[model samples]
Target chain A: MKSNDISLPTVPFRTRGGVRVPHRKTTSTCESIVMTVPSQVSIPMQQHIGAPCKPTVKVGDIVCVGQVIGDSDQFVSAPIHATVSGKVLKIADIPMTNGAKCQAVVIASDGLQTPYSELKPPKTDTLDEFLSAVRASGLVGLGGAGFPTHVKLRVPKDKNVDTLVVNGAECEPYITTDHREFLENSENILYAIVKVKEMLNLKRVVIGIEKNKPDAIELMRNLIKKEGKSDYIAVLALKASYPQGGEKVLIEACTGRVVEMGKLPADAGCIVMNVTSLGKLAEYLKTGMPLVTKRLTIAGSAIKEPKNVIVPIGTMIKDVIEFCGGYSEEPKKILMGGPMMGIALTTDELFILKQNNAILAFNEKDARLMETTDCIRCGRCVASCPMGLMPPLISRAVKLNEIEELKSLGAMNCMECGCCSFSCPAGKYIVQTMRTAKAMIRSAK
Target chain B: MVGKLYASSSPHLRQGDTTRKIMLDVIIALLPACIASVVIFGYMSAVLIAVSVVSCVICEYICRRIMKRNNTIGDLSAVVTGILLALNYPVSLSPLIAIGGSVVAIVIVKQMFGGIGQNFVNPALTARIVLLTSFSSKMSNWTEPFAYLNKNAADAVSTATPLADGEHLTSYFDLFFGIHGGCLGETCVLAILLGGIYLVARRVITPLIPLTYMGTVAILSLCFGLDPIYQLLSGGLMLGAVFMATDYTTTPLSNLGRFVFAVGCGLLTMLIRQFGSLPEGVSFSIVIMNILVPYIEKFTRLKPKGFIKPKKESASK
Candidate 1:
């Protein structure tokens, strides 16, 4: 499917073994509209996958937009920025969807999203300076993993990091935040690719987008050509498959490099970054604004009017849903991301975190559990797994309580992409079995 | 915040395929043969199928009730077994004797172990073997085709099957068209191939097992200095290789394991047919291969992709 419509060469790259999922990219063409500022936002201190930050502002302290209200001394942590310019309402422990409580800075908004002016774009003349700028900007992977981008962007001196892969392969169905980013913020994406490529001293930058969205792929290829860095930056059209955007899977699809088990992507001589995270980094460099707002795709069966909303971080999910014409019906289930790999929310009372890219709500019919039956030994799960791990055999190992067999079957290698369970004819929850198997192996150790 | 929202792990979405749906797909795939059986072997073949199917379903329900387990008849696996068992029977078999085969298939071979996917060996194939030993004369009493075409065709002649010898074997065209003395469904090569294609198209069964099994049998027939076309078009091999040998419960789960199992089945079937005293070997060969599924799977477990290299391999790279 080469596009000779323009002078640019369209890149078609794909890897094997991921299940095909529907792409509900209706919001891909919808330009993001800024949401009305909520009266309050409770910014959680532990948005990233690292040490939790401590709240610096107590109750009744005055705070504004882009103010660092929470900071941690740990190297892996990013500071939590105030998304709204308002008064510090309270510093309280908020319950999270994971059943743990986290410290949050609760701020009551003044209805105006005033800028936090104390910050300025730091120096990026060297590798150390660039990473420090990333950390200062409160940047983390806006993808669902919520990994701190500064740490991911940091490469060791001896690792020989060469290529930089930008993750535009939004493989999850019904989540089009990354797709919208490519369409709306193409210039910012190109700007970050050139800057990161120069700063990291990388050989080339390959932006991987799923082939389902030809518009985004074409735009990226043309944008790179227009920037006059066609040799340094290229675009890759990836096959549309569930979990194709996963770090290890994308790495294999891009360069045919295998990231070793229990090792970092840096070990494979690659650095992967999220598509939206790149745009935000470029925005931060120009405007001196930390990451306070997020682009979220709000759609599902239960949602009334779906849209691509640029809601501020820490806005309550209920308020966001209400802005999109509220629930079409009483929602039975609300997911924090796409239906495949999203975390189910106990309540809509939780505020949006930095890593959440979509909020999917489902009605009773769409959310009900399936009636399970015996596995017919169909081998569909084995064929569907991108990792090529045998799930049913691992399930049997878990049943027999064979810990060594579980370990040998590589139970720890499962990314829980939900491919096996999705393809199972018997409606068996194979991923749950893998999770339980992993837990059993861990406890036995 | 409005209601008691249910929360679980990731993957709230499902592909919505169920056990009943898969069994229904199998029944649909086997429809072409079911119709062909009644047409070729006359109305008695339909009677045999009716008795076998009713007997098996009732036996499954009663067995599950007696064992204090949930009934599995809803999945239609019992119906599938019943039809397969009926297709393996000759039209001359007594109705009471047909019920015995159904009992042996549903109760003894299937529900005794566990229902549906829990059976270790193929229930219908095993039951056909059991009946072959218990009442050999009735089980092998092959009936002539097209008895219903004549108004005064008295109790259609019982004759020697094509498997017997060169004397009874029909022409190649008649054998392929199933106009000869044989069991209800196994005589019609065209009907069975249509059903096999349907199953493969529906993604219910892969073409690997059928291709490997039939390909092995064809090559081995040539090696035995026999007419390969006659060997393939003869009794039961097409039906057994397509529907019976590919039973999910009795077969291996991995692709590699299935390949080895199908090849092994072809080897055993050819050996038994060429060397042994029995005229037919498909049922016995499948049962033998079914018993070896676990061992085949053990040797062919899938290796994880992009696995870590050992220290020695890392140094070599």
Candidate 2:
């Protein structure tokens, strides 16, 4: 009998587990075209993760572009800026995509984008000055988390952060805004890396990009080489996997250091920033413009002309869909981001927030979910969970209201990456059940 | 803006796999064994398979109706159980015994425990055990291949299985090609290999359980100064390792759990066959291991990545 010759790798880097999501980056090569200014824009007071901002401009007040229309004294919140020169029409409550109502300043565009008179670059010779400028620029994590950038960059005194990790993976399916940013804004990103390294006195900076985006990786490597900072700045090509762009996963993938549970990236000696966030920071340093406009990818099954566009922050989703050549069919689902971790919009009236990197519209065929069946205990969910948690066991515990079991299963560590739900052959809502489990665990505590 | 939009949680996309597709793959993988059974046991094998499959489906439908639960026969899990039950029986067994086994498998073993994935043990294996204990004489009555074509042949001949001690050893080629008397599915080594390969390729069953189970059995047989090849080819080892032991509901959820479960199954089978009164031990070994799945899973639970176990304080005087 002839034995089959099958050789396996001796040492596999299986530190993180994630599924290979389809990279339907249709607009990767599409140059970002400026979207037509809407007749009116509605800027929500709350865009970041912390306390909601209070409206500073009342109804009928004239506001210029780059002017802060809303501000919050909270340390973890970012101010809201006007994306167009307009007259505030109303300060009514608007429904957010997450089903929360927040105060929004609705403004009528005057067709004249007047720049704010206070727009000027600030002197940043010290770290405090640099942090203040970032805060004044109204920058948040543009990778879709919407975390206040200044709060994230301010490492606590107890922990040391020596390495700066730039997240360029863009691993989600059907979103290529970051890839485009790397290709078009490589210089600005490199400049921001240099500035951040000097400001924080960091020793190394690593940019993690998935191997699927070869062009982005090559461009970043060449830029780092050209800048003569190859020793300080290295581009690491990661295996294409969903949620590789996650802060914890990216930190581990680039540095081989684990961010302990319930601990920040600073605990691992790393501060991770999104690629577009860094580029926007560099742009703000040079142009002194607040984060008022966003570059996003608009593509899905329902879209007629899926492409990349640079639109104002307060643009309604309906206007953006129209800019992409209106839906080819009735849009059955509208999502604020990529398919894996995006929030489904109940109504198209929601405005594009600062952190939204993609707006997807799916027709009936792509939107309809498969009928959920019984979990066959196939172990696929366990094998694919990036956190290494057992989704099936946690889901069962949730159904039975077993709080102790849920806690022991590490339900709180779940980042809700949707890998378990996506890989389930039975179409089980594994992530939904895990969310319920996490919520139950929290309440029990 | 156009119509009522469906709103749900995150993960708007699916990997396009369904229960029906997975069940269909299992059925496809079992075809080669089905064909081989019919070839070895003559026309009676086909009738038994059809009867078992129909009876199992009907029993599942009736059970669901009585329980007021949604019908799950469309998933074809009941059909797989039915085919597996029939394949485990001797061709000379009466049609009533086959239907009885199917009912036991679908209703008593499966649906009564809250249907497909909720069943604790492999339904087909449980049904085979029930039939074996209740109707031992009829279940053991074996017939020669093509005996139906001979008018003078008896209905059944009390023939010893290949696993029986003191029986003349069959040629390796005949054993591999399934020319001797045994259970329908366990006869052909070639056919079982083809089906096992298909299941592994379709990813319906990972090779962890099957490989570890067979490897342990082969090594133990050699250690006991028995024929390793005979031990692997005879009895229901191939069918149980490939089909029954790999049943999704009964097996553990982690690969480490499965590896331990497979090793336990192999060790128990060796102990039962060598010392116990039963000439065969595949079904017994699997049933015992199935009962220990929870403990196996608990002991072998994977420590999540980046999880740090806190230090424990020693007990002081």
How well is each residue in A1-445 modelled by candidate 2, as lDDT tens digits? 1112112111213456798888889899999999988999989998999989999888888999999999999899998899999899999998898788889999899988899999988778998999999999999999988999999988888877788889998989999999999988999999999999899988888889888899998988888888799877878888888888888888777777777777788888889999999999998899999899999999999999999999999899999999989999999998999999999888888899999999999999999988987888878899888898988788889879988777777777889989999989888888889889978977865
lDDT of 1 at B173: 89
Please name the candidate that would achieve the greatest DockQ relative to the true structure: 2
lDDT of each: 0.86, 0.87
- DockQ each: 0.66, 0.69
Please report how far candidate 1 places residue A411 from its true position, in Å: 0.8
On residues A193-291, what C-alpha lDDT tens digit does candidate 1 reach at each position? 888989888887767888899999888878777778898677878878888898888877777777766678888878899999999999988877899
lDDT of 1 by residue, B32-106 (tens): 787888899888888989899999999999999999998789999989998999999989899898899999999
Off by over 4 Å in 1: A1-14, B151-153, B308-317
Q: What would the C-alpha RMSD of candidate 1 be, to one decimal place?
A: 3.6
